[model samples]
Target: MSQKSQNQRPDEQPEEPKADDVADSSGTRAAEPAPAQDEAADEVAPADAATVPTGTDGPVEGPGTADGAPGDRDPAGRDALDRALTDDMNFRTPDEIRSGDATQYPAHEASAAPEDDRPSAEAPPEPDAARDREPETAASLTADRLLDARDRAPVAGWRRWLYRATLGRVNVGDSDAVRLRRLRENSIKTPLTGGTRYVTVLSRKGGVGKTTATTLLGMALAEVREDRVAALDANPDRGTLSDRSPGQTRYTARQLVQNRYLVDSFAKISQYASRQGSRLHVLASDTDPHVAEAFDDADYRAVTDLMGKFYSIVLTDSGTGMVHSVMQGSLEKSDVVVLVSGASVDEARLASETLSWLEAHGRQDLARNAIVVINQSAGLARGVNVDEIEAHFSSRVDSVVRLPYDAHLAEGSEVSLDRLRPATREAVMELASLVVDELRGTR
Candidate 1:
């Protein structure tokens, strides 16, 4: 046979044919016996026979192969396959894949982006510049703040009149003559009574007419009710109460506060009480300030307890100082509290602060029992307005007693029912009547 025929020919066989040869021979067709067997043998080789590609469009070379054993390719092609595999497996966009090395894969199907980047849902909201930059509205300012500021501001003209309406005149003013005329016109010819009513004037602030108002109120209460009344200057400072009274008296309120034993003797107590004729008594403060300070809470309580029993009304002139525990105790125990303040802005602001302090210290009930009396001591023709003054106080002003400026009243002259100016006297009388009604209801 020729070489071509030899290449295509079947292998020689034994006379007794093997089982494998017989099976192979039967399976192969006559036309392609040898070639078919070779192809079958190639397919049966291990997976490692084919290597990863290197260079471009070629199998990757194995360790010792120059052009590489089977599949070989350039670095570019290898990188492309890596990128394609990453894209298919990771679902990353083509743009992201092309940007750099494709070593990492994107996670599959993440949820939509959150509104804020912060991890916490409870983060505080950021302020908007537009809203913050807007001008403040009238409602932004509180009534209390406005009133407090107003009390500090100075007054002019009609403002002065307004001040007088709330705070009665502390010192003699332009209206003194007119006030006197009014008092003379309004004077009643009623006879004085021996039944006395006592009152106590007090304030946390100095120069707010605590002493002056007490003196004037005592006189007015006596004059209007025709009842016996006394103004006891209980201030340890030995203030102006005695100077306001016309009668001469040696014994003072200090003596009574210090000597509880003496309080038992009506005669001894009477000796201390300054007689201002039929309806009024004046218990002046001691001239020595240190002596006044010597009295304590027990002494004050003893004196008041004794006096309360005897006098129908006892008016105490507590001085303006925060250090006096006895006076503060007396205020707490009193039937009513008269919180005096001037029309000036400082006085009003201070009054409000003091009232707030009192309320904060579980003294709301005490504050409720208080009556605000505005003292217009400076006598400005037109002073702080009544409404304005009320605006400054934490508590309500129960009444606006307008005591006009009266030189005669301040002069410390002889005591006479006719001496008080009309406007001042009428206002005081009205106050006295109010007090009477209040006391009567309590009784």
Candidate 2:
């Protein structure tokens, strides 16, 4: 404040700051203010532009800011008029500055130490850039390499030549069809989690390709999966499951049952099983009528118990006779049931009745979750509408698959995936996928 305003004011406007009052001899505002900041201006001398005393006759030096230096202000005086100084800091705090009475901001340090150099408890410390950083992980470091690298290398056709010619820079991926084939193969290759899973192939009548369907289903699963797979010809009558394989073992399901303890391991079980080129194991029932006729649930429990220890999956080729004792155990132990039907009306009717029998006999759970296979292995559908049969079964079951006729399958010889028609192989693949879906559904 200037002298004229001090004496002339009761309720008067303050005088404008003179240029000399805001600056010092060096033209900076870092200099101290008047010794008695509230003293009348006339008592202070203005001759050499030096210090002035307040209550004494002589002048004395002023106290310093908290950090031992006076703060600089805008030369235009906006900051000088509005700013108030406090104990801790006079300038250079990050934000949230506190203002109070510390106007004696001399350019020199006071002999005494500051009350607290640590900082006020309410004001946060200025953050350190290095202190708040997160550590790097392995995934973060390899992210670019993983994203930019090629997952697959072209092996067949001109795609291989183009990749080699460009020094492996230019690349094109596999066709959508090949990708779909890969995905389909992967779907069936899903791991079988629990102990051995059982799948039963059933039909109310024989000759609807029920036996052929079992052979194909076993082959499809065994072709890709590394786990042990067995198809049991537990058909109450002589089952031909072993005949579909290129070679046959002399031992039968009867031998496996009677000598169950001998087949304690898969190596020993191999004596009774006919191992196929597709990696499928066929455990056939006796060709003798009297022995097959006597195969019952007690025999079934013994056979399955031994098979379960060695195989990851067991498929039972059940007979048309629902009254057969083996059929009861097959249905009871089965995780999935494949009900086979031909493309004829009578075959469809008989198969549908078998499904109804399952529902009526307190196995409604199996009926609802059953997979129906419409066997078109006859190579002709001249007079019947196969669509109606499929739709009928579709309403009652979880899924339905159609098997088209293959020339090799019709020959009643050893089955080979390479020999089957593409349509036939595809139908079997879809059926395998559905069976796998059912196995997972059981979990």
Candidate 3:
């Protein structure tokens, strides 16, 4: 049995015991052979023990086996299969076992906590009333320097005797005191905010002043707007804006739409409007043209939503029947469209075909924001061209004014902005400063 291990070659005879190389004897530890690998290490097989050879001396140690080491355990019964896979592995180290990595498990490193016992993660402390707050800029988001010092204009004993007879160079070279200081800075600048504008004088044709430009633009925006301005004849027929502000209220707007929930505030809808001068509120129409043709469109949206909860400039007038049923609540509550037109050539071809029927009805932005006034009723008429009707409504309009023939707005009766004449009250204060500079350039 010893000739050199008796010249051994029945296939060299050493690997025969493998049913996991059985050894237990109720005590275990026997099968240990495979170790010698490092001939510069990688004959490549450790992808978690490619078909498992973990530590029959070559790879497995403590991270229960299939390669992730921790050091000692092989003898082929595989340390009772590394104590039954160390109750299912994940024990790592020997440089995370020949670099195959991913083994961090003691309940995942105590849930990876330690950044100085981390609780905060930063962003909380802000509101001691927003920490003395002062950030919003763009000039404090449009700083509104408290205005409306009620209707300031008493210094006219001829502008305080021409500012003491020219000590102030004829009151700073007054072209009517610089057009009343640009119509009091376009009627005290900021009005249109969120609701109620609806200007709409409108006139497909009816002695075109459209209730005298809605009673002179609601008395020139209630004589320089401190707000609340209305007019609303919405003509159905016998309108004439209650014969132009002939007040003392016979309560029309069809008795405030049949006592619309007792019309709340603005002094109960200024007792069915008509006031005319301390901030012009008219709302007339029902002078019986068969109860003003049964004033429809939900009674003009219940009298303009109860004068839009007390008027921020309504105006309306609206009639000469442009497909009337009270023009469906004045062309869906207008939002600025004066349009009048009586200088002639059939009133500028019916005000350019009513702005080509408001751009064929989808209101092409209310016919491109129409204004087109031209009410020089009879005087501007010797075959009137008035600059080709102001260059054909300034190319279908965002403004074109005119309004001159005033025998006090042509004897329509009650309008008395001190009986208007200083050049028709400076052409209705330059047409209410071009409709309050188109309502502060669209808010």
Q: Count the backbone clashes (under 3 Å) in each candidate.
A: 52, 0, 2
Error in Å for residue 361 of model 1: 2.9
* Alpha-carbon runs more than 4 Å astray in model 1: 1-198, 257-267, 289-293, 381-387, 390-395, 409-417
TM-score of 2: 0.64
Query: What is the per-residue lDDT of model 2 for residues 220-250, given as tens digits with 9 covering 90 to 100?
Result: 9999776889999887777788888757578
Error of 3 at 3 (Å): 26
TM-score of each model, paired residue for residue = 0.50, 0.64, 0.28
* lDDT of predicted model 3: 0.67
For 203-262, candidate 3 gives per-residue lDDT tens digits of: 787777678777777776776666788787776667677776756667788788989897
Candidate 1 vs candidate 2, lDDT winner: 2
Q: What is the TM-score of candidate 3?
A: 0.28
Lowest lDDT sum, 10 consecutive residues, model 3, at 142-151
C-alpha positional error of residue 25 in candidate 1 after TM-score superposition, expressed in Å = 99
lDDT of residue 324 for candidate 3: 84
Off by over 4 Å in 2: 1-172, 289-293
